[model samples]
Target: MTASTPGGRRVRIALQLQPQHAEYRQIRDTVLRAEDLGVDVIFNWDHFFPLHGDPDGKHFECWTMLGAWAEQTERVEIGALVTCNSYRNPELLADMARTVDHMSGGRLILGIGAGWFQKDYDQFGYEFGTPGRRIARLAADLPRIRARLAAGNPAPTRDIPILVGGGGERKTLRVVAEHADIWHSFSDLETLRRKSAILDEHGAAIGRDTARAVERSVAPHGEPEQAGEALVAAGATLLAIGVSGPDHDLTRLARWIAWRDAQG
Candidate 1:
């Protein structure tokens, strides 16, 4: 029921428990149920306001909740599905991730992205920069983050895996090629293939062996029996299922876990 099977192949399925319209207690209970159900990773999103449902719905801050999750779950990697780069200083973010990494005994995945969601910026008093500017900032900040992580007091429990989500291609894929331990894609099949090749090309241009080095990540499109094969064939080993708040449905999660198990 861990990530790895008896056949030596690993099936890494993640549940992104959307932090919207749900109380902390419901979220906490779901986290426990998910770990018990054998998800390889559990994720929450980085947003100050609800992305759906009521505009003024209940929501929790991302990093603080991650600190709680680090203590709550004994297994399953915990992180934001993608934290906004523009929200915090890169060095500070690095230290927070390191602290949570230690808190979770090294089970943190630093999933990051260029800032989106205009309302979050507007409400939280952060800049709502252009896409180019945002990504440029993320690109510039990654090295600083790495340097800070390297210089931290105790250092990370392990090389914390960086999962870079986008807002891909021209700028983002290149960043992923250079720095990311996992490259996430939620695009369709053709997009997945095309972008993946571009990601490889970026890796090659930089001499980084990206296609082999970065783990390909994707969310399931349909039934796991059907979607899983194609996704794996397309080189996505990580399946991140989005579970919206108020329900945090696990029916599909159970189905995918069943599919993953049958792979053995």
Candidate 2:
């Protein structure tokens, strides 16, 4: 689905601040730089251990970092790329999202997904269910999250944009058609084109115009001009690039920001 905001174009830029092995100061500085560079959104992963290597490496909590970003950034929207459902109760997560939304002055995009990564579940003592079961839970919890957001004591200043990540053709895309404002995927160009077609089919089945229900997004990992042009042509409204580590690279991010500006 393609996202729109009163305008017809679907083009936005986001940067994922992957907290694999970085100190808090570095992560904070990277976020500031992303904001300064005029990126649209900023994100961090929601895993206890490092997803790349060294399971016992340094990492910070997702919501906490979001809170810090809320105070630190003035323009860029911030949230997890996809917060795991298994980590917290759905209602509580909604409350947290609402709080962050208000904290960021209605700039928080609540990105969530079915839980994956067994290391997180095993180490944290949360249940690690089968894929089908996990997706089922995610499907069920989305409405509850929406309900809780509405029922919260102080509702979010604005309706928080929901970003659902994953590319499961059967269940995930259908869920994206049904719930997500932005659908994020990690597929290459050919794969993204195929999956986007499938998502369009799913949206048609549900009577929701996929083109209006959600925005296509992906993580591009190369030169900004080339990657950005390719992804935009492939129906990706939001192009995300991940920056990892102790020394966060803002060079590529600046380049992408310049590209986005050029497109404008």
Candidate 3:
């Protein structure tokens, strides 16, 4: 597929409603509101435990939440900010994603990664292999996932956009170049620039259109006007602002929404 212009492409904003320390009802309510407030995407993290706050805080599984979101929201793409690829079989994950894609009428994005949280590994009994090994597994599994998605009974509503989240200069980026429709990272400007160039180099090995093929994605910092412009200049157009649960404040998200609306 041909790539779209990086900076010139439509700017999109995503909200990562970290599924921790909140009731499922509360999270569901917030998901509904975020969509009405005009977010382009709504994401949850793929972790078995809370990433911060209470170590044993209330947390929900990622894909299940996405499945629910697929039914609940009429608009807004739903996915994990990045799903940990270590947890489920690539074929199973592919089937799950395809099911949700159909459920949402094609509003699904399969965000995935080589997982890093050791607690999820330890408690869930998944091996806490070295980072390189985990990345290698991710690279190896992606093709299987693609094949499974293709082979599934009832094809997906559309080619599901696989979003890969990582910054490793070698393995991770290479995987991103090969499979990711969107490449995500939590990098500052310099890091975004540097690692993006590295991704381009890797993409070149596969004839990836660094400027057009893979969309750049990142978190927002500071004011939306300033942060959004800076990230876009650095080649990131997806501004995903993360928020915690319980209150699940939308102050930042609202501001970003206004910022995105103001862009038009």
Candidate 4:
């Protein structure tokens, strides 16, 4: 949809095509179908195992899948739902993202978050540090990530967009204020509003106007015309719907896509 916020930003639709409990072929087909349907962005989660469905079900790693998507899809922007800062060294992650950005002809968004998922950590041999420690690590890594992106042998295809996912009022939002080009969450309208306000406060504290710099993103709960409209009114320019494995039915996704077209 092309409706702009008071700040003059248009609404955008994103699909989080979760990479779990499905074969790689199914996942790849889903990405192609979503792009064909005119989704503005496509995303896959960063996980070593299923977050839902059978515990040990089929799944794919995040970055590799994103690399594949970069080669496979053409119209839509792509990225991990939120790459775990704890999984790879920050510098290496930047290099990887830059490569994918080039592969996609400059359509990559680097969605990232402080690490979670105990199983991903346990299975990969990464320490399941306390939540505070993980956030601390993310805070320390953001600067290095930016630096690496700039210093890479060949820079990213463009100034890659940074999408920071998480709604922590303290560290996470503060970091978003400082570095994020997009701020993503699964929060409902009221919480989205509250956290956005807190994000502005942090931005002000840091002497930056985050309200303009960071686009607010939320996953609407109910009908798009209702819940999604509320979110847009509450300052979310990006509406993301999450679809997972197996069938990866897009009936609901079609409805949201229709709504976006209508708004335009």
Compared with the true structure, what per-residue lDDT tens digits does model 3 show for residues 80-125?
9899999999999999999999999999999999999999999999
Report the lDDT tens digits of candidate 2 across residue range 1-264.
Answer: 333234366577788998889999999888877887888899998999898767788888899999989988898888899899889999999999999998999999999989789999999999998988999899999999999999987879998999999989999888999999999987888899999999999999989988766888898867876677777777887888888888888888788777777764
RMSD of 3: 2.6
TM-score of each: 0.96, 0.95, 0.96, 0.98
* Pairs that clash in candidate 3: 3-212
Best by TM-score: 4
TM-score, predicted candidate 4 vs. hidden true structure:
0.98
- Candidate 2: segments with Cα more than 4 A from true spot: 1-7
Task: Give the RMSD in angstroms, all C-alphas superposed, for model 4.
Answer: 1.0
RMSD of each: 2.0, 2.7, 2.6, 1.0
Error of 3 at 64 (Å): 1.0
What digit string (tens of lDDT, one per residue) describes model 4 on residues 43-91? 8888899899898998888998889999999889998778999999999
> Model 1 shows how many backbone clashes?
0
Segments in model 1 whose C-alpha atoms lie over 4 Å from true places: 1-9
